[model samples]
Target: MYRPKTTLEQWRILQAVVDHGGYAHAAEKLNKSQSSLNHAVAKLQSQLGVQLLEVRGRKAYLTEAGEVMLRRSRHLTQNVQDLESLAANIQQHWEPEITLAVDLAFPRSLLYPSLQQFLPECRGSRLKIIDTVITGTEEAITQGWADLVISHHVPKGHLGEVIAQVNFLLVCHPEHPLSQTSGPIDPNELSQHLQLVIADTSQSPDEKQGWLKSEARWTVSQFHTAVDLLLQGIGFCWLPEHVVQPHLADGLLKQLDLDGSSFRRLVSYLVKPRPDNIGPGSQLLYDLILSNRQVIRQDDNTATTGNNP
Candidate 1:
């Protein structure tokens, strides 16, 4: 067994020599004397009982054994750097990790922008983003699984700040039977056709919600699935305008002229009630959401008139 008493400084000097092409350049980069850099590498080679470097022309090249040691040294150095970063983050009172439960109804355009804004400030922190349906966000918070939640429903007695509003449009493929109707289609008329519905992703999966009067209904777990099915001319369903905007513009889907104005749902961002439970990372995220609330609430052009709430 080749037991070497090589310090990290010796390995660092060895790597620097290979990286910078020569001991002279490595000494310049590390702000050390060329003799010191040379001595460190020489000591490492002697301790390891191996010839680690061979100078060809002006530069030094690592021998095969030296290459193996260099690779392992990289992992060790990276782990040390990570530990330093974690220590610094802890000193700043930032959470090591934060969990955010967001509603599926929340548009990606809005969600991504918020995350982009949060990334720079919380570089050392980790984030877990959960996409949920109506009650999924609620369940995550109640179960202590989420530190922050962006949801349409606020649990009773918990104060929620309205962050944005998502407008829902009843849309279907152009060739569907509903598109052939002469005027505003009645709710009774809608009950006859197949309705595509996104299944609630909560523990209580049977809790029927939304305008689902249609006896013939197909259920799915994601809005993307429902959108895909709509594009395939499989069924008609009420979907978020933001998710379906490009399709509407491409003429793949058309809004049904319903009896009333468009249906709009207001969404809110809620921090877990106990202030002590939130850390610096979660607090920064919550502040960003509050600041960008109005920007996310703006209406999109895809909305048409509807009568139902």
Candidate 2:
């Protein structure tokens, strides 16, 4: 193998000299003799066959070539430092990556804030988020595909805690026939129109939820698609209140007045698939979600009691 006659220490010394403005200042900062810094830089320049620095009165500056080399060297040094951090994190048993499976019904207001809090504390760990619906969430837990899960269903033999309750409103386009009905509509009447439902994302047999057994039913993979269909006045379906709140406020969609309860409350749980081997990063995120849920609950209560303007 052909080995190059240079070292990272030599590049770092050159960087320090340029950064501190001179050999004397760099030596003072590095707690090294000025002569050693001079020798290292001289040797580095000789090995590379390039003049890296230009010294004017009382200070050192980079040459045209030195600027390019220094920029490249900075990236190299940073990558090395990151690699070291990753090694240390692995040694301490911190997961290299943690996967979180979240149901489509989970409120984005709470999920985004909890993720923002977890970012700074991840310590070189990566986050993988799986957006699942219904049985897909349970499949993630049973298939060992996730470290943490936020879903309505907790698979058998797994433990979970209720973190948030998502309020789902049955709505449709303002011009839809259902919206034209003045009184509480019967379930039989709802079965006459088209119903849009999200398809199960799991590999297992597809399970259906919230279907009114309408002859005209559309099964889509995502909530956004369903919303788009609703906007086109194609069908009506139950959607998360937070997701459709903007549409409702803009008068694009209207909630149906059902004979019974018009809204559905789905209680979501925070589940640990591998509770015995939970890592610190996952645990920290778990706690953050729980704490944020409490604050959200308080806000909801205040709004419900008409205490917030």
Candidate 3:
């Protein structure tokens, strides 16, 4: 009920009438004469330039503005109570916690290291990373399961900006006969080759059908699994750069030249509706992620998310 520059007494008068039902009853509650209560109400109306009550003979009722003010007063009082509770917790240095969901394709090898190294910059807050690769960033935000997510698909509602971009490339065992071809390969020709695919839950029916272009197929649920399979000279799979860097260097997999689709994927940042004040930890973590974005590789790695389009 405390007002900074404005007097709180005026609000008290309004609440009193709302609670006591009439000006005379409010005067009794305030231990003031009826004329004193009347003058206080008039002074408040003049100051605010708004009517608060209507009086008819023995009856005094709140005007529409008065009712509106009463509701706002109640809300303001609750806000103060909440602030007090929050301050008490903060005075003890309670760390705010955030839960996040990330796709399995989150380039864990790189992202996890950076997250741990940069987390201190987030100012002592704790972060819980939830694994929800199939549900995707959009579903995580809408269902309130995560505060932030990363995926190729820009979340449908209140999407954060596309903080970074990365592309996927097709690769296979270097000794495979298909790799022996000198020129760009055709998608239809792949129908005869062994095609290893990482079938994540985020895939649409169309994406599934694209991989179906292969006559002989090996389906692996995770990207790493597909990468291993491809390395074993089993089949080819697209991979993200971070996940495939070491493998590509080791000559475990080789990139395939394609004439049709480049199979590029757009990595985006997604965040939920947040308070105006983003916590120090969140802001710091967000900035660090932004700074390290130069690592977004244009080349396709060993095993990666399939092309969405």
Candidate 4:
């Protein structure tokens, strides 16, 4: 005859009883009379048709069935509290969702601090992240898909503020033929061999960058794909220093000694302009990004310049 009309208050009383280790102690903690606490537990057991308690040596203890129900009651109480918090957050005018587009080359490790800082202030908001390559980051905003973008290339006329500089190194597998070459490898020498390039993420086939030659090249949409193929001794190409440091240390990859200054690219942060409207949560996240950059700058070169953590 188990037909429990269990209220949240009953669950609270159960938890208090277990936490205080006896009915009388639990009643004292909850500021309720021991008789009222006992009545509530008895009523709960009767409604559920389960023996929830037993007294031995002047101490009230939970029965085997009570232990099982008590465990479930904890989760039910937590869920109820979470729902109430969510409702309060909603009432604060928090944005329901935000979309962030980041460049494939952009270091993902740098993003964590900003997100961690934003969580407490924007608990009610949901975030969607899109990883794009080169012009793809720009397209995400132009196509109305992203609310924010962090990339090296932004569309012309859109304002972007520089955040960090990423160093790109020309590298190849240690076993590759280029590693055997004697002198500083020049562009002409590089053109003769296969070049692994990250394909432009744009849908238009006509849009391409860094494609050295048509005769021998491998085009991929993701940088990791290019890295994987490069590791296989298929081709040689320039990749971010942060991304390839581990492979270099393991002697699986080596930098090609070229006669030139070190290659570096500047990356930027761009916020989608909505002159008329911007939600509080989205604004808080954007401000956090700026603050993260400042903190990283003050921190050290090694911390800001690394692969995804």
Pairs clashing within candidate 2: none
Top-lDDT candidate index: 2
The model with the greatest TM-score is 2
| Backbone collisions counted per model | 5, 0, 6, 0
The global Cα lDDT (0 to 1) of model 1 is 0.79
- For all candidates in order, the CA lDDT equals 0.79, 0.85, 0.66, 0.76
Task: Report the error of model 4 at residue 212, Å.
Answer: 4.1
lDDT of 3 by residue, 1-309 (tens): 966543567677777877898888888989988887788888888877888888877877788888897788777766666567556546754435766676666655435555866655544456888665444445665556555666556545555644455557788888988789888888777778877765545433225223457778777777888887777888777677667767778988888887776665756564643524445455556555554543333465432322221
As a whole number from 0 to 100, the lDDT of residue 13 in candidate 3 is: 75
Candidate 1 vs. truth: CA RMSD? 5.2
- Which portions of model 2 show Cα errors greater than 4 Å? 1-5, 205-208, 295-309
Model 4, range 198-235, lDDT digits (tens) per residue? 76676753454553653688788777887898889989
Whose TM-score is higher: candidate 3's or candidate 4's?
A: 4
* Per-residue lDDT of model 1, residues 251-281, tens digit only: 9999898776446555555556446677878
Q: Looking at candidate 4, what is the lDDT of residue 309? A: 22
Error of 4 at 140 (Å): 2.5
Tens digits of per-residue lDDT, candidate 2, 87-171, equal 9999999889999989988877777878899899998799998899888888888887899999887778998887677789999
Task: Single out the weakest 10-residue window by summed lDDT for candidate 2.
Answer: 300-309
TM-score of each: 0.80, 0.91, 0.55, 0.80
